[model samples]
Target: MQRVAIVGPGGAGKSTFAQALGERTDLPVVHLDRFFWRPGWVETPRDEWRQRQSELFAGDRWIADGNYGGTFDDRFALADTVIIVARPRLACVVSAVGRSARFHGKAVQAAGCPERFQMVFYRWIWNYDRDSRPRLDIALARHDHLDVVELSTRMSMTHFLESISVR
Candidate 1:
């Protein structure tokens, strides 16, 4: 899995998994959040974001994590493997909220974006399966050529990591 792509609802540990996989494989890890948001949580312009993604994908090896569907094709096109982190909605919600709380008012690992409460953000995570899964499924189908792995639990994630070629 030289070029890996990871996607999942917010707080599904996509970033954490990507980091772990990158560490084991000695591949570069790109947290899409770092590039997607500007300071104060502003989003990058679409065109610029797409171009940035293209540049990120130009590398020979990396483990990139995020569900930036806008650039799914751009990343998936070059990815050898795509992982779907599939924690339950409740779990995802909890994790996301906790992460935000931990970084509240501080610079988020995601760029310089500051963390704060936003019901809309929490609501989206709450309803992600209903509202976002369909689109994610469609994107995955479009990239059926790549190897897909779904990790629904922590143990599964751990086992999958160990099974991969760890440096």
Candidate 2:
């Protein structure tokens, strides 16, 4: 049983990659956003978030997708591999804005909906450019020895998974 973690700046398609990997591996995938964000897009209490992460990491096999700095050490300690999806700044921002526009004014099926600006996608595109990249860099450096699969394109993502056959 291997615990895999996929982390990247917002709008880098981390969740999309995690979902595809979940379908391929048949393992439960946890989106850290669900644990960190409450309904209405409020930030969950730090203690509560840590507790939730601890519970999720208790499992022997799973995939976690997010770059929450608070629990980075804990998750890295439990992970067998880490996948980071990074793209150029402009690309990340454009994809983020487009996705937000696409999902806007729709009933959100997830536990949380994009809040006013933070969740608006375009705003996050800018926010991530300034903050998310630094957080991911810290996480990656802290776990330098972990098997890191770095992917930037959808084709590479698909090919990476296709190469791994779950027995």
Top of the candidates by TM-score: 1
Query: What is the overall TM-score of model 2 with all chains considered together?
Result: 0.84
TM-score of each: 0.95, 0.84
Candidate 1: which stretches are off by over 4 Å?
Answer: none
What are the per-model numbers of colliding residue pairs?
Answer: 0, 0
**Model 1: worst 10 consecutive residues (lDDT sum):** 105-114
Model 2 clash pairs?
none
Give the alpha carbon lDDT tens digit for every residue of 1-167 in model 1.
Answer: 78999998888899889988988999999988888898878999999999999898898999898988777878888998989998998999999899889889887666677788888988988898898878878877888789999999989999998998869
Predicted candidate 2 versus true structure: per-residue lDDT over 1-167, tens digit per residue: 37998887777888888988988888789888777777776787888888889998898999998878667788988898988887665777777667667777543424756523344555655676476667767777887768888898878888998987774
The C-alpha lDDT values of all candidates are: 0.87, 0.77
Backbone clash total for model 1 is: 0
**TM-score of candidate 1 to 2 decimals:** 0.95
The true-versus-predicted C-alpha distance at residue 50 of model 1, in Å, is 0.5
